[model samples]
Target: MLQGDSSAEGTQPPDIEWVFCESIVDAFPLLEEEDVAGIWMSRTSLPQTSEIRGMMQSGLMLRDMPEGVALLDADLRVIWANHRLLQWAGRPSGTPLGMTFYELLHNPEIMGPDFCPFHTALATGDESSSTLHSMDNQYFQVHAAPVRSAESPRNLIVTVGEITDEILQQQKLAAIHQAGRELADLRPNEIFMMEVDDRIDLLKDNIQHYLSDLLNFEVIEIRVLEQTTGDLIPLLSVGIDEEASDRRLSAHPRENGITGYVAASGVSYVCHDVQNDPLFIPGVADARSSLTVPLVLHDQVLGTINVESPDVAAFSDSDLQFLEIFARDIAFALNTLELLVAQKANTAQQSCDAIHSAVALPVDAILNDAVHVMEGYIGHSPEVMDRLRRILQNSRDIKRTI
Candidate 1:
């Protein structure tokens, strides 16, 4: 059979001639001819060409896609995958085919709100998604959807994209918030047992731990604003030079460095180049970048928290945001501590007043009785009179002490 119309007498010679062949053996001779453009397969011999064409269309659509894409059979075996998907799996084309999807990924742990995404998609004929944490510390967001076709085998189309950075950021944010909450956390026993200075030390230790371990901040300095004296009193310092920590900063935008400026303005500041920044006073040795944020609560600037790094432009906008949030929590914790201290002082004063009230009248009555007895006994018995005088003196002293 010819590929084009057979009406040779009526139609002008077709631009291209068609030659039909029964098999590859028949097409071999035609391929030897210089003018033969290409060989074509018969529709009957290649019945699955339409299906392959559909697959090719899908592959073409997905080839340049940013995310990883794969086709899986009912057995969860990979039947086909795009270049992106193969790259992610660290496999060359055709190697991953017939391998179970999990096996190809080296059995990534499914971190899921939907654990059985493939099963769910196939069973419900809907899309399902799950997160996968691979052995290589990479995180992937995987989505699966049933590929519905009446003539084709049951299959699933799965897409994956790396979400490692986003996941790690979320984890860090959560940890920072938890650490912030724990900064001022004290048990009732601790509150009663620990002195004000001891509580302050605990808070400092907690801040240092979180900043260094959780936030990965190396050089940190925290100062509380002494509202009365306008002094930024150093509350905590780590990896900061002693001289700088004790440099006596105040709420001045111009003269007192970045910490002071942030405290004064109640705004966050990022110093990309500490050497060139006018307001930056050296805190950490070899420091190249710095971030400072005001410890604010209820529209009031409580203090400032500053962090320094050795890499230029080390701090990003996200770092600034995280620091600011933590600073607010620090301010709140500090305020809570102050309130507790004030309440303790007030309680102690009340206790003293109660004791004075309870003892005052009794002591006054003793004084009155002692003096009266002393007056009556002075001329009668010298020893007894002396004893009475001592009693009267002791009662007056007791009243004064109370």
Candidate 2:
């Protein structure tokens, strides 16, 4: 209802009209009309209007939030969902009202630390949280809290946020670490029985498998630096041109391709555009991007690992980081292999020295005894003397060989 007086100049005022609504929510539609100036509820309904207004204020805040927000009734049905929630569900504003919370999300699987979050919130009247994996391979973090009133808990307020990228990245990191561990997983007996070439081949196969399967890298090249010659020796190459694999390279920043620069400077390099990057040399045919990281261990650059792709700007900073980490593992594995070879060679040399030491004195004593016997039998027994002379020559030969 509205009331206004006529002006003292005798101008008549516009006619007043009264409108009635059953509740504040019903009155909201009328407020949008041009003719409706404002809302007027009876004095007895003021408290209810105030409560509804408070709820509306909260809803307005939730509507524009980046995270999905919803108000669920005691039965877990969605009483109201904000704009973000509706957008995520691909639904209109009022469509989700009577649907269950999970139904709105296409019945996502609850990945738990708290599987029954809504139930837990309702029962305990506290906040509960969980993870959800949707049918489309999307991940979400969900938190539910009870909305309480004077009489009892009437609804649950739920918030959901997308975590698909975060979860996938974490899983990939874990897999990379696992693959790294498997790269050098050789028993002592296996190391001892296998030849150097065989061991290197095994390591190469493991690296290729993990790079192609886990990292989704098809083109790769690994080179080991010869410390004495500064030569970059190819340890493994895959999906690379034969000429590039066999190309002679040295650890000179300006001489060889990106591999040499990374080996010499011990810095990772990302070539966003192969044609534009001066340091990049063709590896995979028609390659447009490349990533190279020095295989570093304990501050020393052992070698370099390079990967290429056909797509432009295919790799990112995160790719560089993951490759750097995996390169460290490769360096450690190569170092361990070298150490095993050195240890085996050292053991063999030590064994040979021990045998020579043990046989040296016995051979010398036998030679001296044979010479003395020969001198005594010189005239008496020419046959025995000749046999002793032959024995002396053979003993000397044995000592020399030992």
lDDT per residue for candidate 2 within 244-340, as digits (tens), equals 9999999989959899999999998899999998888787778999999999888988999999999999998778877877888889899989988
Clashing pairs in 2: none
Model 2 sits at a Cα RMSD from the real structure of 6.2
Q: What TM-score, computed on C-alpha atoms, does each candidate reach?
A: 0.83, 0.81
Which ten residues in a row are the worst by lDDT in model 2? Answer: 1-10
lDDT (CA) per prediction: 0.84, 0.85
Residue 288 error for model 2, in Å? 0.7
Error of 2 at 3 (Å): 16
The deviation in Å at residue 322 for candidate 2 is 1.5
Per-residue accuracy of model 1 over 58-98 as CA lDDT, tens digit each: 66889878899888999999988888878877888667379
Evaluated against the true structure, the overall lDDT of model 1 is 0.84
